[model samples]
Target: MPSEAKSWRWRYRFDGKEKMMSLGEYPKVGLKEARDRLAEARKLWSGGIDPLAERKAVVEAKEAEEREQQRRAESSFELIARDWWARWKEGKSRRHADTVMSRLEADVFARYGHRTRHLRTSSVKLNGS
Candidate 1:
């Protein structure tokens, strides 16, 4: 991202034709959003599409996907928990599975004396049994 002459330029090229596209002036866009936009534009070019128009479409589509994911995250806690439990059940003993279920029900949500969710899902609910 280049700021020059009171306008912001996102520089790029394709087919040996170098160019700088105006991405509006500063205070109108942030550096992170601009970089993300550039990445999507390049992805479209690699897939054989025009970059400029595809950049707009990609932003809109990406926003929609993000919104949808946020909505699902807000609405589907139980479903997500069940999905997690199903996966956890895949490689653990019955005793371990029981310990995990107990922890979840107890809201401990962690391995014994551990606070992170990075524990092995298999036998996550470990039991001496």
Candidate 2:
């Protein structure tokens, strides 16, 4: 985002409507930066995409990815377990799924609920190191 300078803002018209987008302040953004931004906007426009919409889409995607990453960090183990169970249970009988879930709760979740490092390993370590 650019700062405001001298009552002027970067303006462009799209679909018969005029829109203004802020580029940084004068001396901060200067002629080259404003030209660069205008060139970029024109590139997007030439590609048949609205610059503002494209920017919004990019920002939204980034925010969504960040939120998902934060959620995974917060409950990665549980998420992994649930995903595993979901895939494993597909086409299985309800009774069998219930029994398997109960056994996992008893034998796995309690011990590994807060300990996730081992969840990714293919075999158990024996050296205790």
Candidate 3:
């Protein structure tokens, strides 16, 4: 153990190479947890799984999950509807697009507000112009 002014870490030799792993900070980790981590790393070595590789795999999986959740949130109805209108309005004159949007707001969106909670939860279909 190096007496440097940094967090306590575990180091060991494996396959003729020296490896280092953080057991966490000194006061927070304590001696017991560091020992536990050392034993765990040894167990990983015996099982033929490199501790560093295992940690990398776990981090990748967590990041992938977060990305998937964010994609779903971005695809929600309110956002998609606004995007669709923005694109569809581009080919039409401003006055015509505004007229069509106002009609939709008055006829379609207005109905949703007065609907019963149960009715609002059901599928809403818009007629194609």
Candidate 4:
């Protein structure tokens, strides 16, 4: 026997077109919750807002925020500089690479290691200007 699948859904018209939105599934969203969701959708529709579009906007905003956070985390100056050095140091002498890293640690990393590399202004000031 094929198991029956059940879900809660609501149908409504928006901009003269019919649309359906899923509230949730059986046992998870109960009858009361489904009715509440339907009422909320109806209220939004009456106010000229498309419930589906609103839901999509919220989802997109959340995804964009997550991407921005990940980009910031990956673009820190120390992370980017280390990645560059790993690739650039191939075939270079160990002493030369160590000297370069020592200078970076003493100078650049000390000042901007935790900062993201996409800053618009240089963090270091030249001649106190």
Candidate 5:
């Protein structure tokens, strides 16, 4: 059998419908803090804003930011170049592909592999240009 857990929650009506929102867990959120949270939610409701919707929007924005950071990390120059090589090597001679990859590792990747795909050309300073 699982032990029961205690949590603080607030129940209120919005848009002619009943809704409940979790404030926090017991012990972690004391009585005073729970009441404070309830008051904040009520204040928002009185101001014609749905506290639940506002909280959901904030959570979604944070999630979106996290996903964007992950995307940028996955799109580094070395990763993109390796992905391209996998497709470009098909039907090509092993020696030719190996030579191409060796040159890229020793030259391009050494200098700019850590950069993300969103980098602009002007941001990179060429040796000759």
Candidate 6:
């Protein structure tokens, strides 16, 4: 209990002849939520299911969702770059617009092709001569 007597720790007891379990700790896991989790574990244990494994599955699902969001960001670089060019062209001379378009299509587009399709179409309409 390392002096933090309030940390979530695995606890067990022997009720006469058989072992029983308890979840130790508070707000770190919250009182109500902790009770709910314990109720779930007890029910699952009675049914022969591992609560820890179930919790791990939930965590993995959440991690996958976060990874998907990151993929979208990486894939959106080209889109955002082209959108920036359109907004910038409004304030730039033709020569500046040409320079910006050349740099972006040459560098940014190739690097983020899969995500750049929609952006490329917008760029063509916005910069069409």
Query: How do all models score by TM-score?
Result: 0.33, 0.50, 0.54, 0.68, 0.65, 0.47
Clashing pairs in 2: 2-23, 2-24, 3-23, 3-24, 3-25
lDDT of each: 0.66, 0.73, 0.71, 0.88, 0.91, 0.66
Query: Candidate 5: where is the Cα deviation over 4 Å?
Result: 78-114, 122-129
Question: Candidate 1, clashing residue pairs?
Answer: 99-125, 100-125
Top candidate by lDDT: 5
lDDT of 1 at 76: 54
Query: Which residue pairs of candidate 3 clash?
Result: none
**Candidate 3 regions with alpha-carbon error over 4 angstroms:** 1-5, 82-129
Better-scoring candidate (lDDT), 4 or 6:
4
For 27-91, candidate 3 gives per-residue lDDT tens digits of: 88888988898788779978887786777798999999999777765665445555678899997
lDDT of 3: 0.71
Predicted structure 3: clash tally = 0
Worst 10-residue lDDT window, candidate 4: 120-129
lDDT of 3 at 81: 54
Give candidate 5's error at residue 10 in angstroms.
1.0
Order of the predicted models by lDDT, top scorer first: 5, 4, 2, 3, 6, 1
lDDT of 6 by residue, 1-129 (tens): 476556444443323334334465665677777777678877876676565656678889999999987777665867677677888899689998999899888975675544623356666568651
Better of 2 and 6 by TM-score: 2
Candidate 6 residue pairs that clash: none
Which of the two, 3 or 6, has more TM-score?
3
> What would the TM-score be for candidate 3 when compared with the true structure?
0.54
Runs of candidate 6 exceeding 4 Å displacement? 8-25, 77-95, 98-129
